[model samples]
Target: MNQLSIFLAAGGGKGGEMQLLMMGAIILVFWLFMIRPQAKKAKQQKQFINDMKKGDRVVTIAGIHGTINKINDDGTLELQTSPGSYLKIERSAISLEWSQQINKAAATTVTPTK
Candidate 1:
């Protein structure tokens, strides 16, 4: 009957709408929980690279430690390990900053005295 066909069509349309809504919600949740955090981390990395300056001590990704002697405009760093030792490294090779404040806080928390 014509009414039966109309009823089936309407039901199918409603199911399709629900499926679309569910897919959209899943994509939104994936972006929020996964993609957004990665984007934020990349932005932070860009800011850190831009803020680099001479005299800042840095640790390279290859586990080399040195003080920044000069910063080149083309994303290169001249590092001084000692009086006469120097090396050129790409800006991305530097990892997070090393700070004495973190060491002091960690030392205080692990005191042997009761």
Candidate 2:
């Protein structure tokens, strides 16, 4: 007999159901621990990209920092890195987490003028 038949014969038919249960549990755990969070993060990233507008400070995935000069209709943006210096980049290239961190730091680090 083949190894598959020998193994099933050894287990007396309970092994097949047990294997199915284990596979289902593994799929559930994988969805919970991996797929769910990734989908949520992707949704948040899409929302962030849609909310971007002119003059918002942002950091690209490649770590380029700039202010939004203009948002193009073709899924691109004009990023002003410095005075008279600009780079055109895709809207999806912005790093949502890094931009939030920098904006949060800037908001908290403001000083009052005397």
Candidate 3:
């Protein structure tokens, strides 16, 4: 009876260890799949925001399209939608590089050769 009890306790301890290992692995996978990519994206966004300069066209998160007229020392951007028409927006408001190449590609209409 004593030997049997000891064997059962050892088996239970191994099962507990395996459960702990599985939990750790799950946490690691969650970080890898979810947390890590988010961190990397945030870093990239920060870099893009910091690299903003005058004359660079950008699209805001709210879908406003404009040229960066000035960058404030406090991280706010002064954007001009048209001559003398400007909006002050936060650095995070900018969404993507509104490059001329992208605009040109979008403007070209393709017709299928039938």
Candidate 4:
């Protein structure tokens, strides 16, 4: 077992480099799968919020549905939920995917004549 012990001791010196490479690969994969997608989605959401204007239909992240009555310059918006009923919320409170899906379903429900 003397040769085996020498072989293991010699190989132990290279383990640090191998472990560092493995950790780097893991970090790269994690960024590609998790961090990258989350950043992209956040950018899209910010764009969607910025492009909004008065009279736009929207659904908040809290599931509150309303039409935008006014787009305030101070980073807030007034939403009209019902007749004479309104709620003021932040632009970031809107949900991009939910609003888009709800709008899509609405558009598909109404068929036009040829």
TM-score of each: 0.72, 0.86, 0.77, 0.89
Full ranking by TM-score: 4, 2, 3, 1
What does candidate 1's lDDT look like per residue over 1-114, in tens digits? 999998998799889999999999999999999999999978877787788788876777787878889999888999998889999999998775442343355678886976
Cα lDDT of candidate 1 equals: 0.82
The runs of at least 3 residues in candidate 3 whose Cα sits more than 4 Å from the true structure, single-residue gaps closed, are: 1-8, 97-114
Candidate 2 Cα outliers beyond 4 Å, as residue runs = 1-11, 112-114
As for lDDT, the candidate ahead, 2 or 4, is 2
- Please write out the lDDT profile of model 4 over residues 1-114, one tens digit for every residue: 999999999999799889999999999999999999999999999999989988888999999999999988889999999989999999899999999988899899989999
* Residue ranges of candidate 4 with Cα displaced over 4 Å: 1-5
Per-residue C-alpha lDDT of model 2 across residues 1-114, encoded as one tens digit per residue: 699988879897687888999999999999999999999999999999999999999999999999999999999999999999999999999999999998999998998889
The total number of steric clashes, by the backbone 3 Å criterion, in model 2 comes to 0
Error in Å for residue 63 of model 4: 1.0
Candidates' lDDT values, in order? 0.82, 0.96, 0.84, 0.94
Q: Is candidate 1 or candidate 2 better by lDDT?
A: 2
For model 1, how many clashes?
Answer: 0
Q: Is candidate 1 or candidate 4 better by TM-score?
A: 4
Backbone clashes in model 1, listed as residue pairs: none
